[model samples]
Target: MTTQNRNVEIEERHVEKKTDSSMVASTFIKYTAYIIIFFGALYFLVRYVFPMF
Candidate 1:
């Protein structure tokens, strides 16, 4: 019984770690996408949109 309980605890910890890692990866991807879009928009404005005035 004690051994089974230990195994369960270990499995739970592993799952928790995996979930944390996935969350971090997703957050990083989201931020990177946002940054790229922001820079792209800024560049476009400076190169083409701004000159129209």
Candidate 2:
């Protein structure tokens, strides 16, 4: 048995970037809903949950 080193060349194909409109809109909507829910919870906490201190 003999040990040998070999070199290999790789070829890459160019790919086109595509954007999905519905995906972008849904992501934006999801983030907006998260912000609204966070603020709403914070408001509720301040209004009713923290007064017992």
Candidate 3:
């Protein structure tokens, strides 16, 4: 019974770790996409819109 309980606790810890890692990965992807979009927009503005002035 104790061994089974220990196994269950270990499994829970592993699942928590996996969920944390996935959350971090998702956050990284979201922020990276935002950064890329911002830089792309800035580049477009500088290359075309600014030059028109």
TM-score of every prediction relative to native: 0.61, 0.67, 0.64
lDDT of 3 by residue, 20-52 (tens): 888899999999999999999999999999999
Q: Which lDDT values do the candidates have, in the order given?
A: 0.85, 0.97, 0.85
- Compared with the true structure, model 3 gives a TM-score of 0.64
lDDT (tens digit, per residue) of candidate 1 on 21-48: 8889999999999999999999999999
Q: Give the TM-score ranking, best first.
A: 2, 3, 1
Task: Please give the RMSD to the true structure for each candidate, in Å.
Answer: 9.7, 6.4, 10.0
Candidate 2 structure quality by residue, lDDT tens digits, 1-53: 99889888899999999999999999999999999999999999999999978
lDDT of 1 at 42: 100
* Clash statistics: count for each candidate: 0, 0, 0
Q: Which window of 10 residues has the lowest lDDT sum in candidate 2?
A: 3-12
Off by over 4 Å in 1: 1-19
Residue pairs of candidate 3 with colliding backbone atoms? none
